[model samples]
Target: MEPSSILVIYVTRIGDTMLVTPAVRALAQAWPKARIDFFGSRTSAAVFRHLPFVSRVGVLTKKRIRFKGWLQRKSYDLALVYGFDGDGPFVEYALRVSRQVIAFKQRKESLNQKLLASIDKTTIRCSNSVDYLFSLIAPLGIPKAGLHLSYVISESERQWAVARLAALRDGGAGPIVGLQIASFPTKGYRDWPVENFVELCRRIRSEHPKAHFLILGGKREWKRTRALHVSLSGCSTHYAGRLSLRQTAALMGQLDLYIGVDTGPTHIMGALHRPMVALYHPSSPSRALAPLEHPCCHVVDHPLADRGATEHTPMAGITVDAVWEKVRAALSGEFPPPLVTPWTP
Candidate 1:
């Protein structure tokens, strides 16, 4: 069926929302004239507004009757449910409003297995989130668009970033290195040690002598960012909790290199196609969500990630020295081999 209108749902965080770009692009390319609507949270919807392919971005906060009335008014021809946040009223509403609903099974029970059997079957799986999403939409006959991640930064936003960075630029400051010190609380295991970040910044600057650092994260990370600021002092600019997401992205686009844990901002930086060193722990494997298609996205997984780690893997295993090697390679437009183990350097 050639659907005239389509609705897609994925209310996850920035990283999860960003991974759907290739799939979204695939839909747009396959049906150039189809109006694509995205159902996500405010932040996630904000991310989609930048994509020209998106016609409307809706949030599912209160689920008021008015909201339901408005959504029902749209009379969407088809609904595509993404992996996370695909349950509750949204799913029920998708089933109600759209002619066809395509979603993955949310449970392992017989009921869900049978429910999913009635829909299209997902025949492929991949460690990479981008590919994982493409598989969900494969039944629509949209092939993999490309591995590249995309974001739209407005001109005003670019100006804001330039102005913000200008004040921090010293007469002799070396390259600008962006650092994301913490991850979301629920995924704290993915965070690299703050002391490691402080030490890594010190060591990198020691080599560059006058390098500058920009610390990036959400407001929840103020404590860590504050502590890191105290340690690095004048050498770094703390933007966590201070700027909007797009503004932070705008600033990130101007950075020479980014060093950070596996977090949403890291994904945003990747979509901006900036050079970066993205860290990961066994809590979440790097392959599943590492920056895709970025020319210089270097992922440094904790050594414990591969060595049969069952419990949470600590960030302590990813040494400053090990990450520094990848940082050096990334800054030089090169990449260290697949896994950045301590023995690599």
Candidate 2:
């Protein structure tokens, strides 16, 4: 089954979108001649840009998918839809645009009958997200290419980030640490305390003396990030609510180290393979979502992670001292070497 053209539809959050990269890479490697186009959420679509394996990237939304591909001929040899929303239009759009479609088993048996393959969600039993997503392409006989998440920053974006960081520092030379203060609204339980962040930053400063901080997040986190910035005085720059997703990622790629909660930017930082200390809530421990094959990954999990902790559990259970030790190790380059398998080009 040599597919000349393929469409991969996955409209989801930034972190979830990042989780799909390995599966996409597997598809690309298995069929090098296939033109693989990705349809992702408006916020997450940009992350697919500059990937060498992807032919194109476009936005996918529930509203816009209503009539898409209805009148068009079957333009793709195959299409794969990634999501559990059986009632959504994503699978319908894929069916219209491709000769063969694959997706998770929908609630409607009729829809399941239409798919080339319907994967049972419960059959997949992987603790790590990268492996979980990579399993989606197994029916195609495509072996896993790599376990690490992939993100590409263009040379221009890198240059722009360098300039922006320099200007923000006003020619100050020091270790620039990026901080993601909070997760999205509903996942607030994953956020380590802001006061804890302040103490961690102070400890980092005391150790390096010349270290500078770049506070990163969305408008929802503005107040918390601002408080931390104020606490750090002249040594920190608050970037919450001020940058685009791509811009945030670009700046993230330039960080000497990144310290963040288990969130989107942490996923982005994971892709960059930079030095990072990610604090995880008990509910969503690092075993399930931490970056695989990361060279300098430092994970600080709540003590109750294995004790059936719930959303009601506070992230404060993970202390600053525990995080500080990981930060110190990351700063001193004391972690083990990255275990990576080279992807086939």
Candidate 3:
């Protein structure tokens, strides 16, 4: 219980890495003097760059030698393993580094529970992943504070956002709507069809003539996003593959509203508590990943009727009209936020 130094390992995708922030915050709040270090992917590590609670953020690479060396240099009182997959090897390293170890164990894994204290993955069934993480430290006597997400932007970052958006900031006449057109390639089904986004944009421009779109996504999306950029030409800025995560987040913070597929930056927007509309595919349920604690954010979801049927994308079931209505409500202060405590499980 008295852990002076902790090593938290969660080597996963960007969204999963950000999901760990609330747990990290709980640890910091409960033990203010404790040194908290994160062992995660380099790309996702940027989200913690300027965060005050984390003392160090370690990036895992192809070569485990340097990572092993770093772990050897510090002795931790506690080790927290977070990712659902490939944690078997990390568990060994954690045992070597710490006097105590606790982790989130997948339900299917047959492990010796006596090896370490742990919470089974199926135990917490909160609609919001962040809330599930908040629940993780509770048995350790770390009380739930509130639903939260953390991605603090610096003043200089704010200034950079301003300078980069100078053209739009020139006393723009209408609302700024940011768009995250695609999810990572693996979850392409989560993406609203590019053609659907184009149709949605047409409707928005028809209603609000001066509205501007800021397109966001990773570099791999560049080839695919080019068409959307061209289709929505003159009214949007494509930063899909251009900016760093923090820079994209700072710019996303400036949006009057955001419309995006469920991805990492969508979580960042949630952290900023931006008024937004988030879209999700049935395979990746909105209940699990929708941004938490954004009062005005609404999830316009279209899950597949047959959960396993893949005749077409579940996203296709979400009509452009349905999304537009949500967008209109969001813009006119008519968005119906999620019903509080909506989770049945």
Number of colliding residue pairs in each model: 1, 0, 0
lDDT of 1 by residue, 278-314 (tens): 8887757787778666667788877877578754767
Cα lDDT tens digits, model 3, 99-180, are: 7777766443543253366777677766667767655465577754345678889999999887877777685746888999
Candidate 3, backbone clash total: 0
- Give TM-scores for every candidate, taking all chains together and pairing residue i with residue i: 0.88, 0.96, 0.89
Better of 2 and 3 by lDDT: 2
Clash pairs for candidate 3: none
TM-score for predicted model 2 compared with the true structure:
0.96
lDDT of 2 at 270: 91
lDDT of 2 at 213: 93
C-alpha lDDT values of all predictions: 0.75, 0.88, 0.77
Name the top TM-score candidate.
Answer: 2
Off by over 4 Å in 3: 65-74, 85-87, 106-114, 122-126, 134-139, 171-173, 303-312, 337-345
Clashes of 2: 0
> What is the Cα-based lDDT of residue 147 in candidate 3?
52
Off by over 4 Å in 1: 62-67, 70-74, 84-87, 106-124, 336-345
